[model samples]
Target: MEAALTGSLLSLSNNLDTQAKAAQKDSQALRNISYGILASDKPSDFRESLDNVKSGLEYTTQYNQQFIDTLKEIEKNENVDLSKEIDKVKAANNRINESLRLVNQLSNALKNGSSGTAEATKLLDQLSKLDSSLSSFRDYVKKDLNSSLVSISQRIMDELNKGQTALSNVQSKLNTIDQVINSGQAILKNGKTRIDRLQTVLPSIEQQYISAVKNAQANFPKVKSDVAKAANFVRNDLPQLEQRLTNATASVNKNLPTLLNGYDQAVGLLNKNQPQAKKALSDLADFAQNKLPDVEKDLKKANKIFKKLDKDDAVDKLIDTLKNDLKKQAGIIANPINKKTVDVFPVKDYGSGMTPFYTALSVWVGALLMVSLLTVDNKHKSLESVLTTRQVFLGKAGFFIMLGMLQALIVSVGDLLILKAGVESPVLFVLITIFCSIIFNSIVYTCVSLLGNPGKAIAIVLLVLQIAGGGGTFPIQTTPQFFQNISPYLPFTYAIDSLRETVGGIVPEILITKLIILTLFGIGFFVVGLILKPVTDPLMKRVSEKVDQSNVTE
Candidate 1:
């Protein structure tokens, strides 16, 4: 009977050991499952993880119940003090049940997108208590239970601690997500308010912009037309009037004294040879007395008119009246003149004053063509050869000089053939044309040879300046002070003066002086080209190479 009892006790002990190992394996699997659920990030993964946790908890409960049954059997057979152990097992089971309830509540809160701070706090408190209870149970098992059961309780306590930490981390993440959600909602509300305000004011803002645009469109053309008219009057008409007034004043001053002397001589002759021609003498004296005074008065009035036209206020008022008149006429009528005059010329169909200006322009244009079209050097030749930079300058100039002369010849002869230009001295006209062409060609060639492409640009600028300042079409004095000051220096000034003398009727002494001045201009440019080109050519070459490399890289 004693042997049988010992065998039964040993068998129960062996069964308990086997169950403890199995429970340990199940607890480890439950720990792994709980870890996986905590690790899950996505909503779907969380749902699946929760389902798996529920399944794992159920398996853990079954293992716990099995252990409890085994303990009850031992208690009944062995008659040991197992009541305290049973109570601890029941308490552990209750703690696990509470944990499962808390986990379920957390899962439901997460599914509904709530942070579940209150539920999570409660769960953390419960988990903390359960951890302490499990630790106590582990200590109790180590003292009262066998080694295998003690190890299993220790592992269960460790897994519960891990699960508690994971739950705390999850709660922290959810709290952060909730804060972000609240901030986003506030930002969206503010944006919606601003957008609503913008919508309310949009029509008024659009209408204001549209009205501004309409006003600009309606008024701009008239403003632009007025500006253009003012510009034309200042640039063209005003200068022409000033020039005409100046010439008229000069003519009156020169002729008036001669006319007065001729009247006095005629009156003296009539007085000395009277009685036979009394009525004629009487009529002559009456004519001088009445007509001469009237003529002087008219001259004074003319001077005042010219002076008024020069004033800014008078010009502005005239422009305003003319613009109004133009509006009434629909731009069809010509500008009105305050007075009219008759021309008393010795010859009929005298050539236009613009003829000399046009001739000078034609010569300069031909020089421009020569410099632009022709290269300054023989690229086939080396710089170190017999031909120096100065020689090259002279060679190129000589070629262009001839070309300029030929161009002048063609233009001058063409004017006679085509326009029947009424030139007083055709030979002198051709000679002056050639001289003007040479001077123009030399100036242009010197600029290009010394400065390269930049020199060409300088030549173009000079051409524009000359056109404005040369007193070709208008008197130089009528232009801006800068142009008037620069006028004596311009080649076109001398050229036009020479050409006008030839066309009108040349004075030998005046023509000779103008020709000498033109010669001096040509010599000056030639000397500059000879002196400056060598210094500039190498620098231009370096600049060209750099530009070419940059262009290639681009």
Candidate 2:
């Protein structure tokens, strides 16, 4: 069966490629004729184009017929609808014929001395209609019919492939059947051997039958006496007994009606109730046909609802998920992850939580402002002559540190007093702010003292980076990986951490660690400021003098 189906599919798929190419040729011819008709300007050219269009229409009709026949064949063999794809072709053909008639009428009028611009205009209009008809016809042939044939051919090929797979399966099943046949043959051979043994015993069985018959013949005389006795009894005695039994049956038959009179009335009553039973059966049938499906669906829906709220266990799950509040049940379902967030030192509000980052930022900005606006090393020539370089450096650095500490004190105190920020330990918050500010100013001051204005630019750059990379506005890990990696090293990272501890509620060990880190940064930068100044000062002074020549103040 599979092989037969495969052959049929292959035959159907065959010549599909050739049919596709023929369709392409007809489509291209139609388009070419359309273009020629549209381009025609002269009456003679229009006449030639109309003739071409009539020919193309004839060709289209024939081409459509071929495909229709193929589709008819498919519909006959397969469960598919051969759609009315030829309607467009037929319409186009009708339109083309009408256009040809119009063109001929115009041409004959011009030839018979009806020549004028109006006549020419009528000719162009008829040709335009012809071109439009042919263009639509071309698309139907080129795109729709070609694609249809390709898809049909592809379906045939797919069926053929499936048939090939089925054929392999059939062959394997045939092999199994052959094995069964072989087993049956072996069983038949065994049966034949048993039949031969039975034939060998058949003569002895016949001899025993003959002996038994002789033995019976010997008892025939005695048997005849017994039969004669039985016959005598039957002829005389049996008739009298049968007549007695018949007399008894007649007597019973006479009295049976009286005995069964109540039974007869009961049967009549039951027979009268048969219509009600029939009506009930009909109603049951109607219910099965019409109402049972809806009833069954409702039962299934009820079962589903019951499954979710079945018993105590289901109720417990619902209560647990809803936290015993039915109002919050939908909200719980919307966000199912029961995230138990635990903030160790929770602050009062967003402002309170953000106080640390902004506080740290204020002090850093304050330090940057001081260094950018204030002179770090007082380079006055008279003061340089009067005071040693160390005294000048210490005086300026001390002044910057003092103002930076003052900036920290104002910011930290204002956070507690004005903002009423949730500062758990106001004293530690103030202390950490002052200490962080000292470090910030020292770093900026040292950079400017050693590197001149370049150091001031470094301070601004650090501010931008810390504002982003510091675990201040957002956690460091949420920032870019670059920020997260360098966060531990940024001065503002530890500064913000220390201030946060005080604002939210201080963790003594963590607060100490952060403050120690801040102190280390301060001491390190302070040492660099005092030590690197003597070395960088004179060299920067000469570079500064050259820059003074350029008149751009550092």
Candidate 3:
């Protein structure tokens, strides 16, 4: 458990580090783009953008410098031979700097749109080639880092296992002494003296545990610090490193249209200088083919290293050591470690909370509605004789709607019980219930309408969609934007949102609007079913007749 948690934390920390660095790079790029788009003069804008590119280049240079420092530190402490990796990183950093310089020259070509149109075009092609090369270089660095981290983790785990075995031995002896005393075994006076002797050895055992724990803690932080320092070194010293990689990627991704527009403008500006522009493009293509593969390999190495570090056990061992020590402290209740982050998230209060009640009510109401409809309609040759289509629609709709509404109420009531009617507003709970009711009605009605036969299939689909898309464990916003857009269309979305707000103090920003939209959709569908009742009956009849005809044909 400790190892797994440590792995998770390490992964999160690594990802966070990546995101932070990426964010910083993106920020610099954004500033550059913003300044370029809003410069007082055309020349000034070009100048600012060039400066931005320069800053990025400088950052990358600093990152490389730091990487060198970390390599030196690692060599000194771990006796690891990282000369090859260090040299590769340094060389790549130098090339990246050269690329940035070329990119800056291209960026400076703005008189109105592009001053050095032919030159800028040539530079872009050169930068693209440079970009690919740098990517490969980074990959290699990342891989080396991973191998180093894996080595470190294994060492830490070995230390922890040794400590645990030593502690367990001490504990077993202490327990034996206690059992002897409790049994009133006076003949075991020598055993009692032996137990006293064991006390003298306790301190040594303690030293071993402390040494292991301290070593793990100190070493884990150092490894992380090294990774950070290395990242900063490359990022700070080599402005071109990130500019050619992340900034370029983001700009290309988020503003392809803008890039194309600017590209066309530059081409037009250099119409008189077409030969220079074409030559630049050809040179860039050639460079990409020749150099990018090596750079890409390097980047892959670096990324692999990053992932290994993120999964290392040094930190996890330290945490476990602390926990075990606390457990060993007799007569004192240990404070529990907060593993909430490691646990499943968007946490539902299922065990002793009103949430379970709400969950139960919703399921029960759905089940009852389904069963009632199936059983009621089972014996009928013509339910139409006793009821008009509109009446049938109204009766069925009313029954289900009531069931949905009541289920929502039951869930709300359960929430109240679990929360003990806390200080949080009950209004949110009510809203959740209402939203849930609407969602259930729409979903049930839709499934019944579509399936024609109501049984286990509709229930399964509803449950699966609810679990996956209902925002139970993870917010739909983190999902694909397509799902983010579509989740609100799901009934469970509102139920989770509103209930979360009421019970968990997670009031949604757009709850009112979402509820209104959901309510409208629910009402609209229900009304549509009413108007289309005659149509549905005839369709059902036709379907039955077709089935009977098939039977006859058979």
Report the C-alpha displacement of residue 427, candidate 3, in angstroms: 6.3
lDDT value, residue 227 of candidate 2: 55
Residue 217's C-alpha lDDT in candidate 3? 56
Off by over 4 Å in 2: 1-343
* Residue-wise C-alpha lDDT for candidate 1, range 1-554, written one tens digit per residue: 22333343344445444433444443444344444444545433454555565665556556667667656654543245566667777776677677778778867877787654555567666666766666666555545554434443344234334544434443454445434444767757655654443344223234433444454554456556655665666688767888999999999999999999999999999888886588788889998998989999999999999887887588777677777786745443554434566543222244545778889999888887777788876575556587877777778888999999999999899877788887777888887888888889999888877776787888888889989998987888899999999988888888898888877776789878888988899899888778878888788779868878888632
- Please report, in order, the local distance difference test score of every candidate based on alpha carbons: 0.69, 0.69, 0.57
Best by TM-score: 2
- Candidate 1 residue spans exceeding 4 A from truth: 1-351, 382-384, 552-554
lDDT of 3 at 440: 62
TM-score of 2: 0.40
Give the per-residue lDDT digits (tens) of candidate 3, residues 1-554.
23442353244324423433443353345344534444434444465656655676667667666656555554543356768757776776666566566655556555346545455445555555655655565455356544554554455345455754544444454445434435547536545543443243223334444676654553455445555655665567556665778888887789999889999999888896888989999999988998788799999998888787668965567567767886544323453353445432244434323452345346436744664455313245576577766666566666666667776676667556765544255766665666566556655564465335542366566566656666666666777676677676666666555555555455456667656666776677666766765676567667767877887632
Error of 1 at 468 (Å): 1.5
